[model samples]
Every structure is written in C-alpha cells, then in structure tokens.
Target chain A: MEFGPHLLLATLEGLVQASVLTLTALGLSLVFGVMRVVNVAHGEFYMLGAVLAWFVTSMIGGSAAIGFMAALIIAPLLVGLLAALADWLVLRRIDYDPERTIVATIGLLYIIQQVTLMTYGPDAHPVAPPFNTRLALPWFEFTDGGLSMYWPWGLSTTSYKLFVIAAAIVTLLALWMLMAKSKLGLILRATQLDGETAQAFGIPVEKVYALVFGMGAALAALGAVLVVPIQQAHYLMGDDPLLLSFIVVIIGGLGSLRGTVVAAILIGMSDGIISVFFTPTLAKILATLLVAMVLVYRPNGLFGAKPA
Target chain B: MKSKTLLSAAPTRRNVLTGLAAAGAATALPNFARYAHAGSDAPIKIGFQVHRTGIGAAYGRWYERTTNAAAKVINDAGGINGRPIGIVAEDDGTDPKRGAEVLEKFANQHGCDIAYGTLFSHVVIGSAPRAAELKLPYFVVSEGHHVASGMLNRYTLQPGITDVKSQVQAMAPFVADNLGKKVTMIYPDFAFGHNHRDFFSEAIAAQGGEVIAKLAIPPTETSFTKYFPQIPRETEVIYHVMVGPSVLTFVKELGEFFGPSHPEIFGFIDSLEAVDFASPGLEFLEGTHFWEGMPRYAQSNQTDADKFYRAAIGIDDKGASLDDPKDVSTYAHMFGCWETLYTIKDGMEASGYKGPADRQSLIEAVEAITDMPEGREHPQGAKLFNGKTHQVFGPQYISKVEGGKLVVQHTTSIEDGLYPDEVDYTAQSF
Candidate 1:
C-alpha cells in the first residue's frame, strides 16, 4: 500500500525482466560482435526455446522439479544445436551476406514459427516452477532503539522471482568468464578481430561462426527456459523478446557485449516500472523513442568501437 | 396473331443464333431455363472464411471442423433443396486485410452464395464492408457487438452466436448477486474488449453493482504481473477474459500474484478454452467459475443434438478428443459455426435458392427466421434472432471448474439478454 513497498515490488519485477533481457540481448550482441550478422529471427529462437522446454518437460513425465531441471539443462543445448544446424545449412549457403542474411533469418523466423505452431498447436502452455515459496518481505522503520524490521503487510514476493534474479547474475558471471578467460573465447575474439587472418592462422573461421551462432541461440534459449515458468509458451511469443533484444543491442552498441547487458538492464527496469505506473503502450513508445534518439546522437552505440 | 406468325416463320440464321444463346443463358443461370431443376442439382457452394494462421487460429481450426461436420450431416440428410452443400474454405490468416481479401475471393473467385465463420471481432469488422460492397451475405460467428451496434451494413448478420452485449447483459446479474458488487475487468485491449467494458459497465450498473477498475491489456502481451498491481485493493471480484495465444500465462500470472488470497475470480472460458484444467499451473483455478457460451463438458441432461455433434467432431464428453486429452476443442465458441451453417441451409431452403440469382432471396429468408429451437439444428441452445439487429439471443452457461473439469451450474434464459433493438437490418434493405 505504501509507496516504498510498491516501488520495491516494481523493482523486483523489473529485475526479473532485466535478467531475462540481459541473457537474450547478450546473445544478440555476441552474434553481431563476432559474426557481423543481424539475425532477425533471434526472437523466434527465444520462442523455440520455450516451446522446446515445454516439449522436453512433457516428454519426461515426473514431478515439476525434475521436468524443470531437465528443461534447464536440455532445452538450451537442443536449441543451440538446431541453431548451429541452421547456420550450417542456411546461413552458410548464403555466405552470411549481411543484407541477404537478414532476409534469410526472416524466412527462418517464419519457418520456425510455423513448424512450432504445427507441432505444438496454437495454445499458450504454462510450465511450473521447481519451487514457489511465498516469502513475506520485511520493511524497516526507525524506532527509539535504532532501526527495526517489521513485516510489510500485503507487500511480498515469491522465492521463485528472487531465484530468477540470482540465477541471471550467476549466468552472466559465468558467461563473462567464458568470454574473457577461455580458449574458445580466444578463437572467437580472434575471428571477431580479423576473420581472414584468423583463418590463415588456422583458427577454423567457419566453425567458429557456427559455434558463435549456436551459442548465441543457446543463450536465448537459456533465457526462455528460465522465464517459461513465469510466462506461457506460445508460438507468437518471440516477437517482443526479439524487438527488445534488438533495441538493447542497438542502444548498447551493436557489437558491445558489456553495453548490451547495461542497455538490457536500463530498458527492462524502465519497462517494468513504467508499465506498472502507466501503460504498457506508453512504455514501449518511450523505449522506441529512446532508440531513435540514441541512433541520432551516437550511431555506433555506447560502447561500439570507432571505425578504422 | 401477327407476332406469332412472325416468330414461327423464323428458320433464319438470326433466329437460330438467338435461340441457341437463350438456351445457353438459361443453362448458366439455372432458374431461367425450363431445365432449371435439372441444372439446380449441382452442389450449393458456401465460402468458409477461416482464420487458419493468426491469433484466432485455435478457434478457426475448431470452427472449420464444426463447419465440415455440419455440412456432412446436411449433405447426407438430403442436403438443402436436394443439392449437396459444398464448403469452399479460404484461410484469412486472422488478419483483417487478409479477411477482406478472402471475402473478395469468395464472391468473385469461388462464386459462393455466402461467406461465414470469421471468429475474431477485428477480422469481422474489417471484412464486413467488403462483404457489403460485394453483397456477399456475410454471416459472422464472432462475439463482437459490431453487427448489433449497427456499425456494419445490412448484408452482414450474426444469427447463430450471441453478441458480446447480450452475453455480458445476461452475465451481470449472476456476477452481481453471486460474486460481488465491486468488479475489476481485465480484458484484451481491442474491439471485443471495448464491448465487454461498455456493455458490462452498463449491465452491472443496472444490477446495482459498480466496476471499480478496468484494465485493458494488449492482446499480444506475454507477461501480466506488472498489470496486476494496478487493480485497486478494494476490488472484490476480478473479471477476466483474455484471448489470443497467451491466455495460459494471463491466468497463471494472476494466480501467482494473488496466491489464494486474492479477490473472487470469475473469468470467461476464453482464458482457458484450449488449456487443460489439470495442467500444473492451473490448479489454482479449481473452484473458480467461468462463463461459457457452451459448456465444454457434456452435462447429464445433454441433448441428443449435442451428443451427436460431439461424436461427429471426435470429441468426448470432456471436450477433448477420444485420442488425446490435450487436444481440447473450443466448445464455448465453435458451436456458432455449426449452428450458422445449419441456419444458412435453412435460409437457402426457405428462399428456394436455385443459384446466384437467388442470393437476395436467401438473405430475406434468413432475416425472416424468428426463432431457432434447440435440436439437431442448434446444439448450443435455442436462439431468438432479432431481424432488426441481425443478432441472436441465446442462453449463456456458467460453469465451475471442479476436479479438472468444467461443470455447468447455471444457464440464463434468452429473455434475460434481450434489449431494445439497436438497428434493423431488414429496414436497411438487401
């Protein structure tokens, strides 16, 4: 009822949104950073992840916890493999031409969407969280003897939501470490720096591209699996995530991973808070306008490198 | 005597050519020739404009199934006017622009006498003008009040399914008396949603209840927790009706936000139409009530007509297929398509329709229908068609979710929903 509790609840909701957005946008950013390709179907990949999560969970009948755990481990791997296969079959055939790849990915979007629709049907499905504990949050008030914590009546959040935030933080840290301190990351960075030179030095450029593409999609799938319990899996659910990921990628700098994470946080928080306070349409309007302003002022994005 | 002599004396080339042309024209027109009955034996074509690939695709799939099943029965039962009924289906993709194009295809390309089976309100609103322009005699199964509101032309009719105005009017009394006085409606933000907002507001007011908060959510929204905080704390009942592809999320999130401590929830079956109630996240809805246009689970007092319809559609008493429990039918809304096809057959028979030339007569005949009693012709319920508004009034069912099945608890009579005529389609002329 009070402003502080409402604001805190809004912030918690925003954090969950930001966590998913960060993972999804990071994938979009990574693909562009190393591959210099705009995957218009990135959102479809996100959707496919959710659908696959539902499928995998349904196939392996058990308690909700086992199903969800299996989905967490398996859905992203399966999605990543599929993305890699698509890269090899479709993107490789096009030679990854920048303009043509955009069109190709758009086609892939529809193909993937229709396939899911045919297989999964046109209904929204809900996945149960592994655990859902209603935890009442406490608000602190200044009393005669320092500050004391009191139970905030009607102001609480679920444990699953908090878990989402923590999980995202852990995932982000792991991703950062993988990109910054691993051999695969080294080859990936080399390809990003100079594909021709990397190929000449036997970096296996094509394979790296395939790997990056798969990893990018897998990251999106990972986000989807995390959020599917909170949201429903529908064939058309990918559009928003795709749009927001592109917005985050653009504003953060198209090829800047760190920038992408920062931008996702900003957009996700604002979207959640604004949507709660005002209207979802207005929140989207403001985000789009923000993108326009960013493009006008800093076209390279916040952390994008200066062109040589 | 002079004209007869002149006509009879003609064995000339001009006379021969004129006679041959007249014979060809008569054969083509069906009703003009002395051999008209022979030519009229050809199948009567009805265009089914279906939303096979968009937001309404779920409903469209079931509507198509119902249409085919009804057509098969009609054709087997000696057909209408002793001619087989043929359904020429075109996918509208659930987009308005595509819906209009489908209607044009029906009129000009397919030569169908009528176009029917559009479900979503926007598509109906979008395609109705084109139907008017083409004089296609559009029969929409959508629940929107657009037809009764007099926004569309006279050629369009909704004589099988009850409109949103009538449905909400019938529901308001039950919601006020049984549920609570202060209501908050969370509906899809579109024309259909607007109808619920406007009509329910007025209807509830007449029942001495007030709508405390109205939340209009975008139909495409994926998540809904952020929207729940906006419901005023004093709200006593949460009235929700969500459509499109994400209804499961809409319901599940509401449950999560409330967690068994929220207001009494009453939802339209739209939110759970295709969803299995036993699905894990939906257990929170065990005791809540939902408004069903037609009860999903067959009742103990189920009519012979409803049983026949279910068997024909391969659905069991639980509204799922005999094969798979997950393959649930949209029982609430799809009966409109079945009933509408029968109505079209009745109209065609009443008009003595022989061909395209009798299209106007068909429209007039349909307008002439005053009552449709519940039977094999209408499995949903009995309906009273108002020729003035081109809308039907029917009984609405309130079903409670018990043990993962929707059980019918109340059925409102047709008169409870009737209101003053908004517009007379008959007065506007065909």
Candidate 2:
C-alpha cells in the first residue's frame, strides 16, 4: 500500500502521544479516585513544572542537564505540596457542591495562568531537546523534499519517541505499584471504595485523601517536567490536556485507574489516527463526540464501577 | 533656548472646536451627529478599552499609561483644538465580552469622543462589532491579520504588526533555507495559533518546502507523548506556536527525547519572553533564531525619550527607544499612541481644528490627514494615513533573540496599515 508509511507512522505517532496522555490523565484519575473530587487545576500544575524547568535550567548559570534534573525532583514536589495546601485551604471547605468545586478549580486555573503570565510573559518557550541526537528507523530516509521507505520498515521515526514510550511504561508501572502495593495505596483504595467505612476502620481517610490529591498533582508536574524538552512552556498550555483528560477519564470511567489508562491509549490513538486520515479540527470533533457517545452509553464510564 | 523653542515648534490646534459644522458633513447625519455628541454639553469623556490581564496586558497596560500621559501633555499644552480632555478608564480584564460591555457604556451612555486600546486579538474581535455599531473609533493594539484583511470593521484600526503574515514573510524563508530539512508545526487550537499555522504553512510552502505535519492540540495541552509520534526522527526543525507552561513542557519533553541534537527549533519570541529561552535549560537555543516585533533599544534614542518623557510627565522612562529599529508592528503599538496624538495636533492645526475635548475638530482633522509633516517626532520616522483605508502604513523588522535579548537583524519597507472591515465585525459572542 502506498499509504503504508503513513499508516505505520500514524500508529507510531499514536503510541507516542498515548504515552504522555496516559501519564497526565493517570494523575487525574488517582486524585479523583482518592479525594472523590476533580482537581481541574491539574493543567496549571503541568504549566508550573514546565516554567520551573525553563527557569531553573536555562536562566541560572548551571549545567542544563543537572539543573533540569533538579527542577524535575523539586518542582513536582512543590506542586504536590501546593496542591495539598489548596485542598486544605480552599476546596476542603466546600466539597459538598461538586459544581462549586469545579468553579473553585476554574478560579484556581485562572489564578495560576495569570500569575504565570505576569511572571513569564505571554511568549512561547523553546526548551532545549534532551540529546538532539537523530537515529533513523533504518527503513525510511527523508530527503529535503519528500520521503521514501524500505521494505517492512516502510517508515522512519525518531529514536527519542522510544524514550517517551519507555518513560510512559515506567511511570504507569510505578504508579500501579504505588496504588496496589504501598500502605498509602491501600489506604487510598479503601477510601475510594468507602470513605466513611475506611475512616471507621481507622485508615485516616481524610489524611490519605489529601496526600492522594497531592500525589496526583505531583504526577501532573512530573508530566510537565518530563515534556518540557518536547514542547515549550506557555501560560495557556494546559487547556488542551485538561479537555482531553476529561474525555479520557469520562470514557474510562472516573475513579477507575485501569480504565483511565486504557481509555487514554484509545483516545491518543484515535487522535493520531484522525489527524492522519482527516484534518485536525475534524479529528477533535470526532474524539469529543466519541466521548459523548461513550458517556451516554455508560454514565459510570467503561470501567468506573467499584470492583465487587 | 528661545531659538530652540522656535525650532522645536510642532503643529498646534488652538481653540478650533465647534467648527465641523462649518464643513457641513455634520449635515449628512446632523441628527446622528447630534446623537454622537448628545451629552457632550459637559466635558467629553474618553474611555480606554484595555487588557489588564492575559498575554496582551503587558503592552496594553503600557499603551494606556502612555495614552494618559500623552493626553495629559495635550491638556497642559492647550487642551486639543481647545476643550479640556476627560478620560474614563475601564478594565476589560482581557476578556472579549467584558471589552464589549466597556465599549457599550462608552458609546451608548458615556458619550466618549473615541474609545482606544485592546491587547488580545480575540478580545479585539469580540469588541469590534459593538464598537462599530456605536460608531466609535476603536484603536486596538492587536496584530491579527483578520482585523485588516477585509473583515467587519469601519471603526477599528490596528496600528501594530500583522502577527501572522509579517512573521511568516520575514522568518519562514530563512527557516526554509537554514533548517528546512524536516519541519514540524505545533500550536494551540485557538484562533491565534491557527493564524500562525495558516501563515507558516503558506510561507514554508512558498519557499518550495512541504509541511510534513501540522499538529493542533487543544488549548492548555501539556502532554507531548501523543503528539511526539507524529514528530518523526527526521524532523530537523520545530515551529512551536504555544504559550505559557506548554512551551516549557514541550521543550522539556523534546529534550528528554532528543536533547540538544534535535534539529534547529524556533519559536515566536513575541508570544513568549527572553527568559524562557535564556533561563529555561534551553541551551539548544544558544545559537537559536527567533522573530520579534521589537528591536534592541538604542542608547541615544532611549536617553532622548527618557529625558523628554520624564521632563514632561515626571515618570520613569521604562520603555523602548524611539530609534530601536525593531519590527514596526509592536513599535506601532508602543509608539503609535504618541505619534497619533502628535499627528492629531498637526492635523488639527493644518485643518484648523481644535481639541482639549474638541471631538468634532479632532476626528475631522484626523480623517483628513493624508501626508505626515517633516522632521516630526515619530518612533519609525513618520506615519502617513491612507484616507481611503483609514489605516497607517509603516515599517516592519526581522529580529533574533541573542544573549537573552532581542536584536534587530533586518527590516521590510513600510506597508499599508489595516483596519477590520464589515464582514467579520462581530467581536462579541465569543
């Protein structure tokens, strides 16, 4: 098929985009599951991580590698703590109305975006890519003009994409372990299942809830820190992922970890596929509609019900 | 000093108010002309529709500051063809609907002579129709090409850079020659980003290159994984049109994968800041290139303006140089107010109209200004208006962000000024 390279590359693109999508959306799910509240300001958390990476590594006189690494460790942790404080200071007082909580998070989104704009200005940031090395897939050689691909391989993509794929896997695994194996993980799951019951069983549900919320926010920051080399930091950069993550979580079933992951992959792949075959705007419309249909069919989401 | 004062004399419109009726175009719509000045029995109220928030706030706030300063200067001089000027300032908060309400009050009830200032393109789009309906001359600082490219506008004039066409024309060819191997385009799926995409693709293609892919992610999208698959290893350049944290996130993720060895990548420095590249582990940008609307302020001109503005208004001159040879778009925004106000004085003097709040005299004189005078104090030399188009034509420059500062590398000849037209005048309902 003449379109073989396009199809193969499209599939590859889907997997790559899926990696970041899953990591970012997974963070949302864990927080929502544990706290029973959606932190809509999650995108802002991502924005902060990018800004931190940009400033720490590029602005100060230091090794970019070391500085960026330092930012990765510290920025996300700070974001987590800030998220915890927000939960304590603002949302904690009014979790009764989920609608109000949504409004509150929207306000938080505005606050963070404006603060970032005031501090950073409204410009696109170009973070230095990791190694800038290029490894052709040995199948397709791209000339200054057009493209040609060899047998079976049929297409060439960047080797760094593999890094993204690997990172996503590692993050998902680590998160899975934290959820399934650790003490906090167990407490979080118990709280997710039944907060009052978990509190009765002496799990300290409230403390676990706050910690869980903070950790999810940390994941967002982690995603931000990791991706700064790929895209760049900007103030309004969080709205897209915020919207897509909503679609992903709704399709996967809110509060369902495995479902979020699976749904993220599906959403990512669908996006890539749509961009490949149709136009970007059409693809978005389709993906959004797909989420709507899924919601109509399964209000609890595809995998959202509590496991019996 | 007396001779210097004579040499420094500019065109002045002294006490020339209440004379548009002599021209008798007031007779064309005398009744509405009466409505235009319905409550002007008192001092004329001038309102500012400005962005105190969003990306445009930085310049918008500055524009309002300078406008107020200039208006004050005029009042002290003699008060406009000769009524006193009164200003009513409202914050649009950088939102379009809010901008519309602010304009509605200025036009419908407050009876302003002219409503000026807007930062964001979308917000300008949002407020333009309402301003047009009220027949208020809306001077916006937005650079959206749609504003001047035959849209719904009779009253909205954009004196700044045309962000899309000008940036693309200046930079895309250089990018095609320097880093045209494999280019990827990624931007927010908003109007601003979309404009970049359309122009970048056109410019790149005109240079005999093809855009392998154009990625339009939703607003506030931070993840790069899903988008990375489309970025083939063969990509030699990336055209990033994102803002805020996404810039950092995108660059960081790109770095984690490709590091400094990914081909040459460029971004719109105007849409961002010098700090983003210099401070944020953007070593890849060490020899990086960028397109900006402001050139490095020269010491001589900056010192001159500083001395003059400070001597006149007693405010610190925390502004760019009048002689900075940057692109004209932003220069127009930054310095256009000073020029327009000064130009109005000249026009009123030439046409024998007056101000302070001489609304009729100022509008008639401004509408009649065809050629600018000699040795006038304008940032980009002088500004001439196309009376037919009601837009100003000025110069644009090419720039590169070097050593964390913007330096002008080249410039384009003066082109026509643009105003939003009639088809797309709806700046509301956003």
Candidate 3:
C-alpha cells in the first residue's frame, strides 16, 4: 500500500474509534460534572450493556436485524436502571463524597464483574451485526496522464462500522440537546452548580443526582451496545474502554462535553496515525506520553474551569 | 504393632477417643474406607492453579472441566497407587504476581502433593520459581517455550503439551510448500509472540522462505484494521497468531479489511480457541488454514481415542459443550489438562508416591517417562516425551476451514516437532 492510501485507511479507522470513545468519554465527563462523584464502575456498566445485548439478541433470535434493533433499546435501558439502583443503594449512603464514592464504585466494579462472570461465563461471545457489507474504499493518485482513483487493496470499511459512527453522532447530539435545551437539564445544571442552594430552591437535588448518574451510565451502555457487534462481549472487555475513556475525559477537560469529544478525536486519531508510522506498541507508548505532557502543562485540562 | 494391640485391648478413654476420631474421619470422607483397604486412605491432592478470573478465564473454564473429567477417569479405575485423586483448585487471576501467590497457597496452605494446570506462559514463568523453592513438582499445560527454552527451573515440567518453539517450527514445511513462502507475520507483542516470531522465522528460512514483515500488535488493542495496511503488498502469505478476549474482533477486522482478495492466510487456532466459527465476520475465513494442536471439529478419520476423550469431557462432535451447543470448549489446548492429570497419575504410580515426602521421587519418575502411545490415557495422539528438556513432542495437525468446519489437511510427524534440548532438567538438583 502507498502512503496516501495507508493514511486514508488509518484516518477512517481512527474515526470509527473516535466515535465510540466520544460516547464513552462523554458519559464519564457527565458523571463527574453533575454528581461530583467519580464512578469507577462506569466501564462495567458498558460491559454489562454489551453482555445484555448478547443475551437479548440470542433470546429474541429471529433475524440479526430484529434482535439487534431490540438490543439497541433494551440493553441501555436495563443498564441505566441498574446504575440508578446502585446510586440509590450505595452512592446515596456515601452522600456522594468524592473519595468514598470512588472506592464505592470500585467495589461496585468488582461486584458487577464477578456477577457477570458467574452468569455470562468467561467466553467472549459475539453478537451479529444487524447488517454488514464490506465497502472497498478508493484511493486517489496522480498519474502522468491525469488524476486517477483506484480501489486500493485492503482499503475498506464495513457497513456496520459506518452505522456505529453515525449512530454515535446522533446519540451525542441528542445528549447535547438533553443537557442544553430541556427543563430537566436546567434542574440538573442548578443541582450541579450548588446542591444545597438548589435543594433550598426546591429542585429535588437528590433525584436530579440519581438521574444524572443513570444517564451517564446509560450513555456508556449505548456506546457499548453499538460496538458489541464489532467487538465481542467479554467481562474483561470493559478494562480497555474504561482506561481509554478516562484518558479522553482527563485530556478533554474534566467536566466539559465539547472538550471530551475533541480529545477523543485527538487521542483516537493519534493512535491510528502513529501506528502507520511506527509499531503498534510504540504508538501506544507515544499516545500515553502525549497524555502525560498534556497533564504536566495544563493541570486544569484544555477546557476545565479553574478550581473555585 | 504391639502398641496398637495394647491400645485396642485396654479400651481406655484415650483409645476410645482415637477410635471415635477415626470413625468420624471415615464417615466425613466416605471414600476413606474404600481406599483404606488398598493403602493410604487419603487422596493424592493435586493443586490446580487456574486462571479463573482474568484474561485467561475462557481457557481456564475448559481446562477445569477437562481436569475434573481426567481425575474421575483415574479414580474410577482405581487412582494413583490406589488413592483417589483430589484436586485442590485455586484461581491465579491470570496475573503473574497472583500466580506465584497461588503456588504458595497450594504448597503450604492447601498441602497439595504437587501444583499443576497453569496455562499462560507469564503465569507459569512467575510461579515456577516458587514451585522450585517449595520443592513442589509443577506440571504446566502452558505450551510456552519457557520450559523447553531452559528459562524455568527443574521442578517446572511441561510433560503434557509441546512447547511453542516446536509447534511453530513443525508448521514451517507445510506453510512453505503449500501456503506461499513470502510471509508477513502478525503476532501479539509479548514473550509468546516473540517466541513465535523467532522460531518460525528460523524454521521458514531453513525451508527457503523469508518473512517479509513482522507486525506486532499491542496486547490491549481491540481494533486491528489500521495495522493491516502495514502488510507488504508482495507478501504471499499472512501468518497471524493472537490471544485474548479481543481475538474475535481482530479476526473479523482482518476479514473486513481485505474484503474478497487477500494473501493466503495461516494462523494458530489459539486465535479462535473458544470462539465459534459461525460468527458474523468470520465467514471470510472459510478457506484459510489453521495450525491446531488438536483438531477442534471431529474429523471423518477421527481416532477412537479422540472420541473417548471428547466423550469424557462432555464435548460434542463440534467441540462445544454437550449441554449448550453455543458454549465451545477450548478443544485445541484443553487436552493438556487431561493428559497432564494422567501423567501425574502415571508418575505417582511409578514412584509409589505416599505423601509430600515422595515429591522428589515423583518428579524423578516423570522425568523417566518417554514413549506415550495413543490410548484412553494419552488421547490427543502418540507423544514422545523429552525427559531431559521436560517437554512433550507430538504430531501437529493443520486444518483448513471448509463449510464452517475445520477439516484436517495435514499431520506432521512427531519427529517434525522435535528440537534439540535446551536444558537437561534431570541434571539439576531437586
């Protein structure tokens, strides 16, 4: 493969990765933004969503399309409800204390993982995509005669991958609307700004916190459901996504949605592009190094507000 | 004898208490009385160090099932030296540090006669030193080069499975002659992968083939399409071997990247060990070849030994669990657990193993084992055990995917997998 086609393929792969990362990081950012509680169990919620997608699809087996459509709706909703239950049972008792909640969520992480292991077993089971077709991408080249376009070997993406990217965009937009243009959003924002003041103003602060936490986990679950067709559902699958999402959230600016999306694109793209020029292991090292540099220079992150 | 007679005749309070204690022990363990007539009533405890909770859990599940089945077979026919085989299993969590701790627990805490059934190479490498330190004979089913390469201590033996160095080298002749010679290798970036890279490269070079490119994917990578571009255009074959939860994704993405046209692909079945062939994107793998330790799908020429082994493990002809068709067993690798358990039985019987005091003799007995004929005991095939290097040599199978089933294409001779010994483990002190 020529350099042009290679770069093009890498960029496309990066975009697909960035799309999933954006949704996952957005969820992490949302939780920290509103509840002021770092949910270490967020990734397990994502894993649960994928596992549930497999369960739902297998049970409702008619066609891949029908089962997948059903899973898209059911898995996230169930995950959201579970997250709300966890918040009510555990997070509420901790009074959303930052350090204690982190520990609590970590405990929640192990509990969810072990329970899933017992129920789902240890195999990595794949859920078929609703639809998948290989689309061979054409690469442009300048010849002596004129500019030409030809399908380069091994330069292609699947129909399902494109769907994942589009679905992530639509979901992120809806999340934006929910946060920016709704009365519930306004209530949530008020609670986020000052819990005691919002409670005094009859905002139902605890209910808002629980709702925010659920939505955050639901967003992650949504991302997981979309990606499950591409990546199999395994209990340990959550570890990589959790680490990557954390890195994206930190680099994007702790609580900023726009920053999270931008940082996801940056990180995901850099990972893909660097692999083209270097070994995959070196690329990972470089990506982590970039995160370190960013942390050192910008303690508040790119879009994080200075501590009050 | 005189003391025993005196104690029984006197029938004092202490004697009565001792008799009651013996009765309680016999009642609590019913098999105690059955085995007492033969010899020592206590069962031979073999500690199972399993990867029950981490990345290796998928393999661990099948390994446990196979181990249990092998133990039942051994005990039903009268166990090692007439004592029933007792498995004391502990989860290693697939982490090296946890693996070492598990070995300690097996030795001191559980009082196991020997530790066995570690799969991951890193875990075996980490825990084997501790096995040596505790003088516990560690029999690993892990097909890593760590044992044969002389990296591990004398106590650590791989008597069940052939190491990666031998397996990789054995496939070279078929690959160079049948699959094209200009190979591009893609493997995980780790010691296991490095072993494949180095050994295969040398073996292929000996066959007048060259490795065009070597692409090492990071262990944590979930998606792999971007790396496909790095495969040289002139490459005639792509040799890939990957392990982990994301392997399905890796294979699927490779299929999607190449579309209808690609190089002849050869891979280790480790990439799809517990995965089903009927997976969505795996349709593209219909014609590719894989090097299987043991054929996953039962062949038309399948041996009676294989049929018996599969039946014992409760796996169907397709290698899935009998209870659930979707739950595929790690057929290619899990045979090691079955064979290793039997090897332990053979060693104990030969050494006349009585307790932990006989651990050294048991190790010596196993080191003397060489020819293992295909039978109810050694089911995979006839194997030639290297008593010196502490690894086994067996025929390797190459299978091609035809109609979503792996059909055996070629079987290399046991001599094809034999390599010069790197270490004489028997020469080292126990």
Highest TM-score among the candidates is held by which one? 3
- The digit string of per-residue lDDT tens for model 3 on A1-308 reads 88888888888878888888888888899989888888899899999999999999999999999999999999999999999989999999989999999999999999999999999987778898999989998877889979988999998888998999899999988888988999888887787788899999998888887788888888888889999998889888888789888888888888888889999989878877877666666766876776787799987678888889
lDDT of 3 by residue, B1-430 (tens): 4365534666777778888999898787534234433547678888999988777888999899999999998889988887788888899988999999999988887778899999988888889999999999999999999998888888999988988889988999999999999999999887788889999999999999999999998666777887888899999999999988788889988888888987899999988988889867788899999999999999998889999999988999999999998888889999999989888888888999999899999989999999999988888899999888999999889999999999999998899998888888888887
Candidate 3 or 2, higher lDDT: 3
Q: Is candidate 1 or candidate 3 better by DockQ?
A: 3
TM-score of 1: 0.91
What TM-score would you give candidate 2 relative to the actual structure? 0.69
Q: What is candidate 1's lDDT per residue for B188-265, written digit by digit as tens?
A: 999999999999999999999999999999888888888887788888889999988778878877887777577788
Residue B309 lDDT (model 3):
95
lDDT of 1 by residue, A76-108 (tens): 999999999999999989998999999999999
Pairs of residues at least 3 apart in sequence or in different chains that clash in candidate 3: none
Model 2, span B245-317: residue lDDT tens: 3445555455544443566777665434323233444555655666554443332234354355534433322
Q: Ten consecutive residues with minimal summed lDDT in candidate 3 chain B?
A: B30-39
**What value does the lDDT take at residue B178 in candidate 3?**
92
Scored against the true structure, residue B429 in model 2 reaches a CA lDDT of 23
Give the poorly placed runs of model 2, Cα more than 4 Å off.
Answer: A1-13, A51-61, A89-137, A140-165, A306-308, B1-46, B55-95, B105-112, B119-122, B142-154, B157-333, B345-360, B373-376, B396-430
What is the lDDT for A141 in model 3?
Answer: 80
